[model samples]
Target: MNQLRYSLFVLLGACSYGLHSSLVKLTTNAGYQAEQATGAQYFFGLLLLLVVVLFTKRVKLNMKQIGSLLGLGILLSLTGVFYATSIEQLSASMAIVLLFQFTWIGIVIESIYLRTFPSNLKLISIVFLWGGTLLAGGLVSGHMDWMSETKGLVFGFLAAVTFALFIFFSGKAGKGVPTIQRSLIITAGGFLTVLLFVPPTFIVDGTLTGGLWKYGLLVGLFGVVLPVILFAIGTPHIDSGTATIVGAAELPAAILSAMLILGEQITPEQATGVLLILIGIVVPQWRSKKATHPKKVYMN
Candidate 1:
């Protein structure tokens, strides 16, 4: 029953994250420059998180902690830049499929650092994920444009790398710290990093007519605030491997949102790919359960 609750929380987190990508695409498509939108979102998210921190009466930050928080914020800023740029270059579905590669990257990092091997079930899950990626991404499609596809693929991979780094570093920074304070610091860092690049003209022109503030607020809530809150709450209850697999739900959500909201069509092969991805995600968790509850020993 506890596990069940954790699973639901993880699912909710994934759904929030999935919706975030689509909302970001909408704001970008609405003529807001990626930098402006990203900057505003982070800035606003920082404010929102600050409010939460104040309301909850979290721990006060020391000087050294402030420095670490600033560093984390910068990493998050880079993450936003890469992610937003990738979305502009690639369709959200393809971009998300690529970003989800962080799952494998995270596993490899854990295996290396912890000197542990993934279970056989996890190895199979990796295969399913890759196969599904190929199918969903139309790599098998004969008419693929190698150059454009390659660029998108490269950016997507970069996003995955950065995202993995963000997760790793954030976890490190948040150790012995409250989640709200950690979130605040990271958001502030991201806000500062983006501020360096966002021009004065963008701020001067701010209005609903310009669409920056509206979409910025949307991305702040959906992309930044909500996912952070959900994941922070959910991760403590589940193992990392299970949490990672469940998070893959974001990919399918991106694909479906692209189809319905952006009018991107999925070919039959892509549909099959989606199914494989879902299977891959589910298989690992199911296998984990089986391994943990092997057949009872028969007593004499």
Candidate 2:
């Protein structure tokens, strides 16, 4: 029952994350620049988190822990910045596919850090991942948009890298802190990074007119607050392999959200590619044999 509950939590977390792409697109369409949107997200995200922390829990972190958490925060902020910029350059669907590349990138980073090669299952998944990326990206179908694709590829890959680092470091840091408290500190770190990248004038001007608040709150709710809290709580309960498979839910969620909310086109080839990617994510984590009966056997 506990496992089931955690699985559901992770699923919800993925869905929340999936909603982020469309939300970011919406914010941009509402006339906010990418930096403006990203900055607002972090700024308001921190404010929301601060309120949560003060009312529910007080975070107490040592200097070393603060340093590690802040490092993770920088990576998190970079993901927001890069992903928002990427989606601005390309369709939400395409940008999301590129960002989802972080899954395999995380695997590679893990392998290198552990000084070990990927498992055969992971290698097989890698094949499907790259193939799906090509098909979903429209590269295989010769439907590429040269100019936007170039910019999207650059920022999307950067987002992927930063996302991988965020995952890696978040796991390593603040092992002993309570979940909510740790989340607050990490959010503060991201807020700092956002302030560094986005000019104060952009954030100030956006806030003064009250135009950016709705989008800021939206991004804050979906992108940072809800997903972070869900993942922080649920991920600790699941093993790495199962967690990885479950996390793949974000890809399809993002794709579907783009199709439904943003009216983006999803070709049959892209659908097939998405299926392949999902299959790759699941195959390695699947159990090869059924559970054996403990006390009874059927007669042949």
Candidate 3:
């Protein structure tokens, strides 16, 4: 039952995150600049998180942790900017594939930091992930423009690096702090980081109009508040490695949502690539399960 609950949590979290990129795409198409949309999402997210913190009595911030949280927020904001910008240049499906490269980045970084090597399963999965991404992005689908491809590739890699940094720093900041408080601090950092770009005429120009506010509020509630709350509640009960793998589901979810909801087409090659990536993700879990239960003896 606990396992079932955890699986549900993971599924919900992945779906929320997956749907978020589509929302960003929609808002951007609806005449909101990338900066404005991103900024509004985080700002409203922070506001919602604060309200939760207040009601839940989880408002506590250690001064000592402030520096780390601030730094993390700045990094995350940059990550958001790069990702949002990439969405403008690349298809949501392609952009998501690139962004999910953070899984490999995280594994490499952790391995180096711990002075250890990745397990055989992890190594194989990493290889499969890159290969799958290339196929999924339709890199082989006829000639590509050198400049556009180069830019997309660079931005994609940058997105991965920055995302990995966000995860690393979030983990660091989360320690010794209540989950809600930690999330609030990080959200605050993201908000302030975006606040720096809030134009002087933001108020006078009526950029934050009623409709924008409504959409922004919705984005904040679903994209930020709900995911954070769900992940926080769920992660404690799940193994970190398993959680990370489960989270990868967001990649395909984003891609499929874009295809179905936004009318994006999925090429045959890309579909095959998606299947490879899924295999890559599943194989590791399968191996781990086998290793854990070496013999499946019948139970009476």
Better of 1 and 3 by lDDT: 1
Kindly list the per-residue Cα lDDT of model 1 for residues 55-142, writing each as its tens digit: 7647767877778767866865676677666767777556666787887886676577568898887778788877887788676663
| Model 1 CA deviation exceeding 4 Å by range | 1-4, 62-72, 86-97, 142-155, 207-210, 236-241, 287-300
Residue 136's lDDT in candidate 2: 64
Q: Candidate 3: global Cα-lDDT?
A: 0.68
TM-score of candidate 3 versus the correct structure, residues matched by position: 0.81
The sequence of per-residue lDDT tens digits that candidate 2 reaches over residues 109-215 is 77777878777877787777677766665667675564656878899989988876776565567777777778887888888888877886755554625788888
lDDT of 1: 0.70
Over all chains combined, what TM-score does candidate 2 have? 0.81
Quote the lDDT for 32 in model 3.
80
* Candidate 1, poorest ten consecutive residues by summed lDDT: 166-175
lDDT of candidate model 2 versus the reference: 0.74
The candidate scoring highest on lDDT is 2
Give per-model TM-scores: 0.81, 0.81, 0.81
